[model samples]
Target: MKIRSLAAPFRSSSRNNVLFLSTVFLFMAYATDAQHSAKGDMATEQKIHALISEMTLPEKVSLLHGNSKFNVSGIKRLGIPEWALSDGPHGVRAEVNRHDWAYAGWTNDFATCFPPGTALAATWNPALAYKQGLVLGEEARFRKKDILLGPGVNIIRSPLCGRNFEYISEDPLLVSKMAVAYIKALQSKDVAASVKHWLANNQEEHRDSIDVTMSERALREIYLPAFKASVMEGGAYTVMAAYNRFRGEWCSENNYLNREILRKEFGFKGVLMTDWSAAHTTVKAALTGLDLEMGTDKKDYNEWYFADPLIKAVEEGKVPMSVVDEKVANVLRVMFNTKIFDEKRREQGRMNTPEHQQAAYNAAAEAAVLLQNNGNLLPLHFDKIQSIAVIGDNATRKHCSGGLSSEVKALYEITPLQALQQKFGARVKINYARGYEKQSTFREGNNSGQSGSLNVNWKLIDEAVAVARESDVVLIFGGLNHDFDTESADKQNMDLPYGQEILIQEVAKANPKTVVVIIAGSPVQLAGIVHRVPAIVWSWFGGMEAGNAVVDVLSGKINPSGKLPFTLPVSLAQSPAHALGNFPGSDLKVNYEEDILVGYRWFDTKKIQPQFPFGYGLSYTNFSISQFSTDKTGYGKNETIQAKFTIRNTGSVYGAEVVQLYVSDPLCSVLRPEKELKAFQKIFLKPGETKTVEMPVKVADLAFYDESKKAWNTEAGDYILQLGNSSRTIFQKVKISVK
Candidate 1:
């Protein structure tokens, strides 16, 4: 059994205090259930109450914090049968095979690796994200897993955060919306979506013990929104607490957050599980609302460490039986809702269906955003571009996918070069080169490498340059690989992982007809090359079928319709979150000096132009915005007004547009952000196609956490609502009064 010493301040064990706490939980469990049943849907609570009433102390404690004994069994409560919970946002990982934990296991070689969260959010197509969720969920269910730890909704607080690729954007609104869709679709297939890294857990370095302290406003507005939305909107069935501490208390046992806020305020009626081995202690974790203790340190609950202590506390009236009941009840409620205990169990099978693969492919394709299109350089007709040169080290390597937990052990990763060759065949003479080698050169492992050494192959680059000069068009595949972006730790610099930048500059010089395709996890510093490169495509870690997807977009088989989910910083130093101080340490304090200025808000408020603004992307067609209107009284009394507009695709080619709406409150008690993302809509259009979109301005959306009032409220004021394709360009605008 695992021995846990209580953290300081929480280590109090006076007999009277223990007894008093026991009575509180005992009464709380029963009284709360009675009151809740009198008001809300009591069906779930009713069954829970009945089960708790009959359970022994050992049974109750067992139900509260232990996993299945069997490695691969489904959820079976009554016996020694094990319950399965798989690792997946994209594909399933072998939890049984311990060796594969470091490197995504080779046990399952055929699992489809889907695009990371950053890429999926860029699509701005919630339906496509949902489809991908369904595909992954189906695979998880087939693996006999009750829950899938996925759809990581943590914000990109820092550019140096190693796990940024595994997460969504810096903006909470975008993260929340995407998380909701991912959760909804995953649960739609009867698989529970375990939306994870609960709160304020951004960086992975020292994550197990690091404490994150931030303004409550920043907490509510930026970090917590995604978790709130995932639970309230997406109806997520399980929540995995992060390894970090928030506001001086470990998140697993943070009463203010887990119990008072999440369970009470957010109304998250789901099972709260700890990140693997995150549990600090049994009693403390239980009292703080930690429902499940994962991993094997504690072994079985019948052991001395758990059973003896738990029973002693209960018998002495120190720990309440009601607290145990509530935890078990929550877990049971999810199982009942998901029908995990049903008599007619569904047959376990492989989820390699064509529909699932096609869904994954579509998601990968849509997530590829066209960053720059000078003189309409993209959608190169195969016939017009007779010979194509695809060059770069990443051109043929598996550079599109990131690592740790989300990694894939695929049968094959169809790279951009291979895809180009397959798509164009003999018609295109695609030449490639390992433009640069990894920083960890074969000669020196980790210690002895010059800071700015270039590992370029001059001969190969010269040959590629010649080929590019001869070919009709050139596609230089480049960008950061999984080594540069992993959950294990953060990267040293935001510059391109290796010598790809040099290759891009040199390649562009040799062949002016070159198009740069960046397969990166996060935005990179593209200073000199932005204006020089004729066309730039931001292909963020496209999945297993990435090759086909890229080729389809390049060949004009599919119109590129992806938007930037996060603001593309010109350089890492320009980012507002840069100077906050080094993370993974409590000594370095963080301030909300930027306040609500995140993503496009930072760029707009500071008037700093990004290389490519948020929600900015190019399609094979052109679009126009017109007929803007607003209603002051349409939203009811004391509510924020409404803004509506019409969009039309003027170009002949079919495409999709992400209609973005921003709201600016002119005056407020607290210095609020200049404008916030109010609403967004994705619509498809053919030649001469047009559609009208209306956005309801909720009074709640405008509200800031008023510290004096000790509540969130919207101060009455005049607001400017703007509509456009991106944050930088507000094409249409209207005024609304909030009384």
Candidate 2:
């Protein structure tokens, strides 16, 4: 939080320094009219209009096209500077040194990687999301970035999504709540928060070309809610159109999605940028509300879809001049809002600070979901344990530099081995072994370089078992890495890859007190082995301080409050999306056959039990719910029903609990999910302390998106409001009639 002065230099010339030549042409084009806007003009409507008057048709058109891979041209005549963008949402992407899409290899570009969206969602706390965003925003501001294209909230429609690690959750409410907090915190720094892959972009395979044919009702209910909340509630001013096509049109140019749903309905007030090389045409893209055309070609910037093509159309009267003006105006508005055009530099050098690291650790600690604790084996006593064994592929793997474009150049990352050694110090003995690995591993931690084949092969399973037998307890860190869960390739199956499952089974036999810690973004079918393991921890691909956070929870320094963001089905076939068909669709098309019944809704509706239900996570201690009551039994469309429930820490330990509130429509005109999450709150309580938490359910939220009427409508019926910790664990219920 310190400020220093530095000369405001032009953007680093390494990337788009070629534009310096164009600046001369711009200087000669309107040298007389060229002037900066009045200092501190506040960028009102009048100022935007006045600035637009200075630009020629060609200048306006140039501003709409991709000048570089990640930016649009800026009008020098109007003193509008080009806005720069960073990729990969978890952190500010390492600054690119070359003009081509490559990292700068500079020390300054090494950002502190925070936990991914899936980890954040697991915390079941929006406050933690806010903290993550605040630190992320501060770093982005220091990097001089105008927009942070982040906090991807795409529903986990398929756990097979290679990029599911980047997205938040499988439910709309969980996704929306977390997305809103991140957006609010980032934008508060005056940096535009652009939520990406706007619609039906769940899976990464064939993402750029696959056409997702889903119903409008499904779109409005499951997929659209997160994007809608980010825009309509969180006040996000930027959005990145998804690569996939929805219905028949690409999301970048889908009129109903971009214009009708996003802009007209949700009242989004910013620019819509297409995913890299996503758009195909000028007229369809332009008329359908695609504001800024970026990355039409990944390698070069010459073959643009909007620049020269849009200019000719405007002059030929094929496209109206007004359409061009609106796009230009929106870009300028964002630039002004982000302080890109401001003369005075705000601040600098906020990267990799202590606060950033602390925030990363705090968020990571809260996100570790203790899936199972059999016979009370966890919270290992430091004095009683003389020797420990840590074994697995993820023990040494680097998660931040994985398969996604958001590959982070983390300044420092602590491995599980390093963290345990630091925690135990000279007090306890720790043994380590790479239980299993693959020869052609592409994940960052396995190979010496970024993304490529490596000469790695499975090793040391016997050595791991020997170490486990010698130790008091075996801590097996095994699960998917970037290879099993990353972009461009959807996983073949949900089983733990690389023979880690066999390693875990062997280690469990060697040591009865085997604690299995699975490092992954989503679930790996644990129905078979979970029963055998003494304890199980679902540790996500945590951030830079992941190692320390993991140790803190294991040693009783912190209590695990994280919950399942999605259901852990007993088998892949048990999931409604798969059981109902259309998931992982064939012939280049995927259908969302299970309209509104996604995740827990599917399990609850189908009466099929899952291995671990959504919102289910274990604390070190137990809690009891009592004194459940509601404010009223009847409600109107605009009224809000307040429900109060008491939660007491019944066990002899302090812990946090997530109170999940779900609304059920017993009778309705159309089919609905068995229950839909309305709202939730995360609260901490001392041992023997009882706290009454009141949650409000807005009647408007009760309405379902009626595809026939093309609106969200409510019905007059008796609604059941249930209070519980997990989706299925209903502690209390009350009935209320909607009038």
**Strongest candidate by TM-score:** 2
Query: Which of the numbered candidates is closest to the native, going by highest lDDT?
Result: 2
Q: What C-alpha lDDT do the candidate models reach, one value each?
A: 0.74, 0.82
Quote the lDDT for 123 in model 2.
94
Error of 1 at 553 (Å): 1.0
Query: How many residue pairs clash in all the candidates, one count each?
Result: 1, 4
Q: Could you give me the TM-score of model 1 versus the true structure?
A: 0.88
Model 2, C-alpha of 638: deviation from truth (Å)? 1.2
Q: What would the per-residue lDDT of candidate 2 be over residues 1-739, giving only the tens digit for each residue?
A: 0111121234454324435445555676666444333334443557788888888888888877777756666777668887777775778888774356676577777888888888999999999889878888888888877888887888898767777888889999999999999889888777888898888888876788889987888888888889989998998888999888888789999998988888898887689988777888888899999988777654445457787778877878888988888988888777766667667755442888898999889989999999889888998888899999989868777788775676788889987778888879589888887887653455432222223222223357888888998998788887777776676667666777766677777888889899988888876788768878989998898889888898889888999999999999888888766787767788878888888788998999989889999999999988998887889888889999889989999988899999999999989999988988898999899999999888988899999989889888989989988889999998888889989
TM-score of each model, in listed order: 0.88, 0.91
Model 2: weakest 10-residue lDDT segment is 1-10
